[model samples]
Target: MTEPVPPRLLLVECPGLEAPDEDDGGLHLRRFGRVVEALSSVCPWVDAVRPGVCTLPIKGPTRYFGTEEAVLVRVAEAVGEALGPFREGGRDGEGDVGSGDFRLGVAEGVFAAVLAARAGAVVPAGETARFLAPWPVAVLSDPELVEVLVRLGLSTLGGFAQVPAADVLARFGTRGIRAHRLARGLDGELSGYRVSGMGARLVAALGHALALQDLQPGFWGGTSAADERAGEVLTALQRRLGTEAVTVPVLEGGRGPADRCRLVTWSPVVARSSPASSPGSSSAPGRERKGSRRKASQAPLEPPWPGRLPPPAPARVTVGERPVEVLDRSGVPVGVTARGLLTAEPERLSVDGGLWVPVVAWSAPWPVEERWWSTARRRAARLQVLTADGVARLLVTERRRWRVEATYD
Candidate 1:
């Protein structure tokens, strides 16, 4: 368990605001709301783990902003600005609100990630156990267990981690086992740290209508408490997990399913705003993006990865890596030409070195290509084939190698 590598995540902590009191008149919650809103601009999946702590998957931002260190800089700046608005009123109520009010860190798991944020340090990859070893057992957040462990000379997580897993389970039961996992960096989060339904509570604390409140579920052509609640739950889960952990399919213009379909973070606001652009046969398993027609006389002869495939959509889209062999009646291999035409008719096919099956019918190969002069240009083709066994399958070829692209039931 010492090497139980943690997930890469980014955490934001607001120390002064974690324990908001009645005397603060709900200002802390409102300010925290602004923090979440600002962070949403940086990442749609900002999880409000609790009142003053939150986390987001660090991978996307790291790749986008260049590095984990860069992500922390960017997040700290955004959170600072969010808390900036309340700064002028610092003397009135908000206490010294400034960029220093927030801290950001990057780590692999939620528990380690949270401590990293509080300390404003990045827990280097594979170093979570090292980073946590010296911390007191109290950070585990089990006060009663903390006392017992401390009394037993397990004052620090490192010592506590030395306790064998079996002993922890046999002596201290489930709670001790949980704490031991945290010590050894085997668990990223515990049960009680994240508040249930935090999204709903945040909305209630804001005490104001949301930007898209009236049309929250309008994209589905109707609205209901059920839908709104569901959206809230999704938002909560996003806060608990990272945004990349949740996604929704979006249809866009392309010749094939892989190019036309994408997975995006599910947001009711986005759902309501985006249009239903793709049109496909009722039989297709998924919604597809439709390519627009050219108005000018001299556009490229072939449409740019545009247009729907003729009629009855595929019942299934494939992972598309399954290799295949296609041959003509003469047993010569078939191929697509520089002119985008087949060199020979496909008379039979075999999948993954299995027995050959005669091809009873196949549509004309549809050419796929890049611009004529691009150095790294791509050239491929897709064809529909009906085999002797009566299975309707879609096949594609590039550079003479063939593979399954989809299947029709």
Candidate 2:
């Protein structure tokens, strides 16, 4: 047997990309190019094949940069610097970029490399088989040829490689033959990233608490070891940004304390709940309830985008053009409460006074009347009002009284 040619692959995964928001696709690719440019600085010979994707001929970098491990460390650092601003708000308290959910995979070949990236497997050379054998055939669904192999029961890459190439083509056609060749490490093919980086990008920061911790099967707390790792990453990000006031903007529409803020022109808004109605069980009980409430809001409504329209809760952080301090010696917000954004009047409320201020805002009667027959809770009215501070949500109680629940600051 003769020696097989060496294969070196690098796979990068960038998460948090939303589907395109417009037609041009140029802006998307441009942003991706920026990231590629940053990566190019560390490894100059890298090929910027697409906006979000790039590859370095690993042999050159490994040789020039001293070692494969050293090259990867440089790549990781450069990527974090370039992409860190994007993941500004993370659930884990660590504020590192590419630290949120992005991953990288290094392997001996392109197929194995991409699989490793998806699986979060960073395989060293001479170990592709250990990494590739366990992955199911589903990942090969792309390239059309792999799907044929899967349908023929050659589900694993290892399995595909073992089959005779001539027999594979005879049974499954030309595509299968091509797939077998690639699977068996017989070919080297690279697809130019023609689409570019086409998507919307939002930066979010995982809270410091989230970064230093992992879920313990059924519990929530930071492991001491993980906490040290988080501290190192946080310190690195701080050193890069050159600021002690680095606070990530809270993501809007989050389930708790943070949400997006928009500068929409203020208007009196009407609120309505999706009338309780399940699909297909119609015309008798459920249909009657929905029909009864059509008169409440005349606007035609679509089914609730699952959980998108959950009752808005008052978010607790301060949001402004400048960063707000999040902690003090006691680990408490020295400046304000969670609701301070909704009530604190910078112009009127004196700093020396108590945190609470009396502001008149509308509150919807709690237990707003709903379909009486079904189990769904309904209310007669939903409160919509604005304050000098911002917007607020009030909940009516079972006793028919109202209290401020949440505010949009």
Candidate 3:
């Protein structure tokens, strides 16, 4: 059996930092997500560490595209298309936003890829050590370690790497050992374990034998060791506590507070790419066709609905079985009147078994009437209120009852 190929990694850096305001930060994060989604179209093994930095394992793509340079060119073009019209002043005359300078780097490992990105260089396979040799020890980002290296006259990465590995470990501990390994281009040695093809075959045979013996295999084909271990753990827990014991969060898109997200079974395959499928392949089930093209043509992921609540969205939203009470000055429960107006001004609000909180400020009520022509039709008006304790809440009134929809921290 042939040995597994060494990973070729690509690092992509976005142009800017997050803005100070919450809304601005959300916008930046959304834009960053778009970039990663776009890159996923080219290579599914993309990992976005933040809005500004992401890495992709490009070994498969480099082969599929014919050459490493070809893959790089394709990625650059894809990014440029996805981030349309980002000019110097942030927007063009037609109001199209443009992304600023983007840097791409390719190397044998993540650390090397990051350094290559900083210098806008691509280090070829088996040459990572040579490329990193002349770089300064300060690149490690540990000021204390750099000072020690400087005092020892080891200013370059090569000099630092030349120190005995055992001595480095003895002096600076694990962190220093890791830095020394990277400086010596031993990233793979430090981070990954190499299992021979014979060993993998033996493990697979053992799994099959266990399955035949009426025992669960707890392993799947073509998955990483980490994924197999997680599956085993989940299987053991479920066997002891039943299937419903384990669940994972799933983010759903919607306009309502309660409809936005939910929980489902923890399936490892949910995020894993299929080994038999290629990126942008139409043959893959449930895979989008022309997704990349559509993404390139559309505006960024800005808010789709107008007149919605602004950012710093609610941290907690509770839906109660019974309605809460809102009262006016005369101690009367405030209800919606005939003309869609409140029977009396809302001065204070209280939930069952909870203390009344005075309303400090409020905005005009916005009415929503859904499925008006059907038997399930419902009408409600939503009010945004700030309580005396400086908490922002969304309240909705249906029929004669008031309920708190969400609370913003």
Candidate 4:
């Protein structure tokens, strides 16, 4: 056996993702071509002969580039330019998803490098064992071997790798030994591949749904109360999802929930708003109606919509693959977004054909039943609802009577 030259490896995994069921194989090829072209510019020795694969031999480039960190930055920039414009819009304004979406991993052995690329992670030289130690057992195919190891409590790559190779083979046969050897980064079939340019090892996406309740209130003169509420809901959601904080503005104000105007506020510019400069203000009838302020005296602990309420406490939100980092007033990463009232767990509260309430000390619907047909009543039914934020006790009526007794979010 001979030791191979230590080569820095770049493995690109393109899942050929497109609109679901659109099976456009040619588009996938074009994506690969774009990535390869980007990578080749940085490392002139790039090649794209493999289908949906570009192997970059980084030995020469590493020496020329001086430091791997610098190389990574340059490659990330080049790939970003090559991918053109893949941005995360709507809520996240940090940066767009482009060439930088790619993952690069370097290791002493080719097999480990390939695995690292597939996993969208990186392992510096001589740390293959440490990197592979926490990987799942399913990375290897044999189930019987896994069961035997589990019974012995030999879980994790590190534990399995420590067992004698001969003993593993003698008990579980050749497949078990092969699995063990692979775990130790000793695969014989891994052939080193050449690099062309830039490639992405993984891709993550975020989809957003704007708050319906917030946009109902007017943005100007504080008519869009629901818009602001929607913004609050969005803030709560973002806090849960683990993304950067978002600013919200009204799309329309003083309309119904569906008619409320709302949109995400992004862009680095912060221009001051002038009251006289607002568009279509001269024609709006409510612009001059100054008796009462529409903006909530304080953002309500619970929204005023008929059936809507702030969720209970102890919520968990995952924005994407990246962990959420809540920022302080100074814009520094503060903490993960998981907490009480932020977890958006769905719970249905209803009876056979009417409104139902739980936690009332009995299964019978006391509050709703008492006020079934009280149209002229000033006060009607009071019921408590549970959510991720906390418990909200609400009062309902047949007509213009409504009040929220308590809420937790």
Clashes by residue pair, model 3:
85-98, 86-97, 86-98
lDDT of 3 by residue, 112-215 (tens): 77778889988887778788899999877788888998999999999998899999999999989987987887763324222223222322422311111122
**Best candidate according to TM-score:** 1
> In candidate 4, which residue ranges exceed 4 Å CA deviation?
1-8, 14-22, 44-54, 86-100, 114-121, 141-144, 188-409
Q: What's every prediction's RMSD, in angstroms?
A: 23.6, 23.3, 19.6, 24.0
Count of clashing residue pairs in every prediction: 2, 34, 3, 49
Q: Report every candidate's CA lDDT.
A: 0.73, 0.45, 0.63, 0.43
Off by over 4 Å in 1: 1-6, 23-25, 88-100, 207-409
Q: Estimate each model's TM-score.
A: 0.49, 0.41, 0.43, 0.38
Q: Model 2, range 177-293, lDDT digits (tens) per residue?
A: 655555655444333323442222211122122211122322212244244434545555756776453433322332112323323221112002223233322323222333223
Candidate 2's C-alpha lDDT? 0.45
Q: Quickly count the clashes in candidate 1.
A: 2
* Model 3 TM-score (2 dp): 0.43
What is candidate 1's lDDT per residue for 177-219, written digit by digit as tens? 9889888887888779887766666777775432222332222
